[model samples]
Target: MDATQHDADERFRGEVREWLEQNLTGRFAELRGRGGSGREHEDFEARLEWNRHMAAAGWTCVAWPVEHGGRGLSIAQQVIFHEEYARADAPARVNHLGEELLGPTLIAHGTAEQRARFLPPIVAVEELWCQGYSEPGAGSDLAAVSTRAQRVGDEWSITGQKVWTSLAQQADWCFVIARTEASSSRHRGLSYLLVPMDQPGVEVRPILQLTATSEFNEVFFDDARTDAALIVGGEGNGFKIAMATLGFERGVSTLAQQIAFRRELDAVIDSATRNGAIDDAVIRDRLVRARMTLEVIRQHALRTLGGEQGDGASVTKLLWSNWHRSLGELAMDVNGPASLLVGEEYALDDLQALFLFSRSDTIYGGSDEIQRNIIAERVLGLPREARP
Candidate 1:
């Protein structure tokens, strides 16, 4: 960055820091105290309210284009905003799919009217969205999805069952990909559509996990109708369009998520310190590794915003997810059994929740194995394997 860039970035950071110091006290303090404190559902209403509050102040999607209800801050400003928010233990994000994935895809490929209709509500957190990509047979091999979309006059009637649909029960809308023309090659016949979940013939059933958390769901769409106008890109281009959406998901958004990791890192260090374990060689070695990993995250994700997203996004996602899991385990190793308690609001107990959540990181957004394949075939010119 040049002198002017440095000065302007610092000015924005200073402003954000001051505003947070002033208006970000009570709720943030409570969240910090609560840290991984309750049932995931218990935080839903409060999280939604906080999302709208931050959106109203242009703090929710601060990196979005100025035309799309954002501050149009430089990547550095956005990083500063995220770091401060994480340090303050700001409320958890509530509009993940909408603000992170769907809005950006619409901005890039949807018509002007589509952008006008969709992006604003996402940034405002007035609309919530879930993804309908993975199906009964298509988890990692997304192109193998057999869900059908039949065009009928001005509308496309969709019929499919999507499993592992996170937050689908709570989402007001979903971005679905189905086989528009099933006869062609597997990858050639797909198309993406934005469908409303509140309409008739749409059912969302919770899939409770071993942890007893209902974060995932099974969505059945029996003749769910979405207008042709809601299509994201041209027919038969859904696979390509879905790739673009995933790029946004794993690329620029990784920066904010890395900031979340930093917060967890601090919590670990704090616990280690209070236990007088900081002086131990073992704990200090882990702290050093954590700090170095943090720097790598900033350099690789936050600073690479100007480049084409490409397969590097997948690489970064896998890297961060693995790092998160490792950090959680490290916390437990340093802090002991007290760090593994469920819904524990007390210090050291939050690490338990963090560890539990880390197991899902490799699964969501695409698995680590899938990311490695992308990096190998797409970026490294490797040969493709045939499935039996």
Candidate 2:
């Protein structure tokens, strides 16, 4: 970047750091380092309040356009902001699905009316959202989603199930991909509908995880209804819109995610030192390799930030997910035999929770197999995988 941009980013960094330092006090002091990944159940209500507090200060959605009530930070400034936020150990945000994924998709493809209705609440953190892309049969293969939504007079009635929905219990709305055409199959005749989560027809059943938290859920839409106009990108275009949302999913926030990963690594290193695990040649070598791979992940992410979307996102997902899963394994090794035991009430310490939760890292957010297939077929120009 140019010197002028560098100066501006530094200034933005200072601003973020200062604001977080000043405000993360009093009632919010306990929220630091709470709520993320396996620990989403930690101080959730307090974190929600903290999120709204940041929104009121214009810190949320820093990369969104100024017209959308965001600060309109440049990509460099956004990177600076996230890095500083992570440095401050701010609590995990409760609005990521809305701000990072749905808001941008709406800005890009939603009608003006939809933008006016949705964008403001997202910026204000007044509403929360969950994604309804994965179903029992269609986790990575999104085109296989069977959730059906049919037009009923002035509204659409959705009837089907969505599994692995994040934060559904707290979400106010769901951006769902449902089959709108009865005869449509695979990637055709689908519509991306914004359905309210509070209706009688919508059911959210929490799916307990290895972390002993229910951050993920199975949401049943038994004729759940949304306005006819709530469909994004128009009818029969859900696949494209959903793919765009997935592309946004892997953007600048990844830098902050890596920062969190680094914190976990540091903790593991500390544990090894205290427990004499650092004396083991195998453990020490693994730790060094973990640190090296993390830097590689960071560099790759920075390199591909504003580049092409699909294949680049796939490569990134593969890199970090594998790295993180490996880090979790190393954490267990560092903890030695104690890692096998749970605390009172089956409670797990952070490292134990990390080990268990990170097992799913390669499985969720498009599995490693799906990512490799995307890279092979799309990036390498290989023949497409034969579909059943």
Best by lDDT: 2
The residue-by-residue lDDT of candidate 2 on 51-160, one tens digit each, is 99988888888899999988888778888899999989999999999999999999999999999999999998999999999999999999898999999999999999
lDDT of 2 at 134: 93
lDDT of 1 at 380: 92
TM-scores, all models, native as reference? 0.89, 0.98
lDDT of each: 0.79, 0.93
Over 4 Å off in model 1, which ranges?
26-42, 273-284, 337-348
Tens-digit lDDT track of model 1 for 1-388: 8999999988988888887777656664444423231235546876777777777777877767888877787767767877776666666677878877887788788889889988888988888999999987888778889889999999989998998888887899999989999596568899989999999979999987645567789999999998888888889899998998887776555665677778788889998999877889987998899889888877878655742376788878877888988887888887776555555334324677677768777877788888888888888989975664
Worst 10 residues of 1 by lDDT: 30-39
Question: Global lDDT for candidate 2?
Answer: 0.93
